[model samples]
Target: MNSGAPSSGLDTEGLYRVSGNKADQENIQLLFDKDHTVDFRSLGISVHSVTGALKSFFTALPEPLIPYEQQKSLADAVGIENEKDMITALQDVVKKLPQIHYDVFKFIITHLHRVYQHNQNNKMTSENLSICFWPTLMKPNFTDMASITATLVSRTPIQPFILHCPTIFRSRLEPNSFLQPAEGKLIDIEAEPGNL
Candidate 1:
């Protein structure tokens, strides 16, 4: 295997030497370090609301009746006029919560494009660079994944690369299985296309 110091144009100090051959994992560690200046944006909901929602869902008594006042407030929050409308609204909120979180995460990640570009101009030493991304198991939004991939692919110094995605079971499986070109062909492929 080839090994050398990453090009001076890349933020070698920021890049952590991850154990596995996965770029996504390494990138995550690099970006999330406490000292890293990068900022993250999450869903706007308050911590109190999130905690309250969880508590209300898990701790409610069996066959419990919804307190009239609490039910009315929930209805108002969701823009519902009656009990049945409230149930539908609540269900919709529950269903959309995960999606909202993902959108927020994607927004934060997309903002990293500026950092990546800055690194490319100042620290890039190699003719080729690699980036890895792993789809979260909770809810995979193809649009967000595609957006992140597209942003990276559009950058310069095209080179041979690998994107390793672990199975939900954590099995190694096939390295080529989750890999694909960052742009061009719309279809998702198992590995980098020959052009890359």
Candidate 2:
């Protein structure tokens, strides 16, 4: 994701709000399927294409990124009224995530937070990003009113989770960690992309 999103991505007004060309996104997806490591620039892939591919990847996962069993727990955590309690409850829910899910969630949320920081150009605030990602991250069974209500409320967490990532996932994001916010650097869009 970092490979194709640096210079142009920062200035993209809609960012994830817009869709990439279908053909271009499909090509990127094929490349990813063949090999996890893809050179985005070699194929002249656009940032939108990369972002689209990312969404596709998550959507195609056997289980939603947040997982079915944990959705209610996450929603309940987000519903906490107190700020500190909310963060604490959120942390507990996050701790229960599968390792791979937790890692990917942390990485993506962290990246989105950084993007939100440059919203003057990208215009993708945490709220906008949360809205965009809510469906992709989890899909709740809307079998009943309670489940529907819980899922609707669960959407609230995506924004706060992205904004308060450091506080919520402090243990996973230790000093000098790869997921550390300070470690983030701009990807040179002009340069050849690296493998994931």
**Candidate 2 CA-lDDT value:** 0.74
C-alpha lDDT score of every prediction, in listed order: 0.27, 0.74
Best by TM-score: 2
Question: Candidate 1: misplaced stretches above 4 Å?
Answer: 1-10, 13-99, 121-130, 135-196
Writing each residue's lDDT as its tens digit, candidate 2 over 90-173 gives 899889999989988887887777677779888888899888887788755577454476667855558879888778888666
The lDDT of model 1 is 0.27
Q: State TM-scores per candidate.
A: 0.20, 0.85
Ten contiguous residues minimizing lDDT sum, candidate 1:
157-166
Per-residue error (Å), model 2, residue 62: 1.5
What is the Cα-based TM-score of model 2?
0.85
CA RMSD for every model?
21.5, 3.6
Candidate 2: segments with Cα more than 4 A from true spot? 1-3, 144-147, 174-176, 181-196
